[model samples]
Target: MNEKLTKEEIMAALNERHSPEKQALLSEGRVAIAGLGGLGSNVAYALARIGVGHLHLIDFDVVDITNLNRQQYFMEHLGMYKTDALKSLLLKINPYLDIQTDCVKVTEENIVDLLGDEPIICEAFDRPEAKAMLVNGVLEHFPEKKLVSATGMAGYGSSNTIRTKRLMKNFYLCGDGVTEPEYGNGLMAPRVAICAAHEANMITRLILGEEEI
Candidate 1:
């Protein structure tokens, strides 16, 4: 007779594909994401699947029809706050993950508080201004924390241009590093997810004390 799988067994099976050392590192790492749109949603999902134990998701926006294109959300999540909806999805991926959501806008005055003391920060905002604000705020106020941000993930083709660069001590930027959203190029799933993957991978590397790519 086949044995029934317990919750622990299921979790072990889910994580059996990863090396024990990497899995242990991920389970002890905590990261805070500054946005919950295309980049943030995908970053959180990737980290959760990889067994990141704690995630702090900050977003004040609600799910809209337009976000269905590339966001890690479903139509059923429409009208729901991004943080709440994202938390629901992430938990389903790893039920043991500690996901904390803040449904509030991140501003210069409150960015530090919103992000908390998480050692890693993921800047996944769609707007240039918001991204800059978070990066600047972290660099100036929380220099001890490592930050990963992205730029120019818009448009299609030339996906190879999307690269992760170590900007400064404890700081990294991903994407083509030039394609601003206003270039009349539309944002699609392929490139956006590519950039998010870069950010997520960098975070994983940082957690494992691996050299920057």
Candidate 2:
């Protein structure tokens, strides 16, 4: 990074060709992600690494020992809020990055407000009902915001099967939507990471305006 460049400026200049207008563009970009679980946690980490200027992460659930299997929270962070745990670690990775953390469950009533500011929305909720609520809420109140949702990724599967599908304009979903926790035989690390990567990849493309969704 250039000595004179601000964190934002350095990131902008560093990825100038792929990210135009320097910090100016990043300054205008913000992403809201619901759920800080196996999917959400990895998604946020990837976005932070990519130098997104701002992020709003939400999750009311507290970290547990089970989460260490696939989620980003550590053993030391047990009992910590997932949103708080993620925020604590993410900021350390990029102090210049702006993060707004909300330790609250995402329901239809609040999903709109929680997601209102960001141009892109990332759906990382593990439960089908909660994920559906967020998706429906977005479609109802904020129709234009780009969305990346993940589903059916519970079972042990090869990483290659996890892929991003452009469902429609501004809407992208990852994974085959086939696996379930009951039949998952159990969730493992690799599947979680693969699905998360697909979601994060779509998010980055949307942010850069490289893809419609």
Candidate 3:
């Protein structure tokens, strides 16, 4: 016979790993992720593993075979919408999670509506234009909210180069900031996940009341 852990049992294990106080704070954390590519997918995985109670996953793209190199999706998730696939994966990690999924592209017009409810927004688009759209849109429309973004995480550069920097009172940037895929080898898992960890850690720090990075 197969057995499944109850939600309470799962939560108890999470709290034991995260500590009761830290898990309590994490459980109250809310974030909206824009673009479920490498960075966003890894960030969502890290946060969900740490017991972030609520997450709003926004992505218009479907999982592609190319995404297997760096994204969290598996072979079984190919062709599935990123939001749906990621939500399903996250639920497997933390079944008690509260998740919201949006399958529409995050255009300037809809960005505010998609992310307004969440206190922190993560920009994880692959293209520069799309990244700018989310960052600019969130900063312009929701100045009071926090935005975490990434740049130059592509290629097999030194993992140490991946870092988090405070860009403004409400914005943070992660990654080497110099190794664009066009110039470097291309997006690899280690560097991408390293950058994503910076973003995820920064978001967690913010959630835990440590804003400075």
Best by lDDT: 3
Instruction: Give candidate 3's root-mean-square deviation (CA, Å).
Output: 1.3
Candidate 2 residue-wise lDDT, 1-213, digit = tens: 434446765565547644455435545668898989899899999888767879999999999998899998888899988888999898777778899999888876777678888889999988888888888888778888888899877777766777788887777889977887874466677788889998888887776677753
Best by TM-score: 3
Give the Cα lDDT of each candidate. 0.89, 0.82, 0.91
**Which stretch of 10 consecutive residues in model 2 shows the poorest summed lDDT?**
17-26
lDDT for 145 (candidate 2): 87
Residues 34-122 of candidate 3: C-alpha lDDT, one tens digit per residue: 88999999999999999899999998999999999999999999999999999999988877899999999999888878988999998
What's the true lDDT of residue 80 in model 2?
89
Residues 1-213, model 1: lDDT tens digits: 355446476468656877677678888899999899999999999999888888999999999999999999999999999999999888776667889888999999898678766999999999998888889999999998999999998888698999999889899999988887656577888899999999999999999898557
The TM-score, computed over Cα atoms with residue i paired to residue i, of candidate 2 is 0.88
Question: Order the candidates by lDDT, highest first — what do you get?
Answer: 3, 1, 2
Decoy 1 TM-score against native: 0.94
Q: List the RMSD of every prediction in angstroms.
A: 2.4, 3.1, 1.3
In model 3, where do residues sit more than 4 Å from their true spots? Answer: none
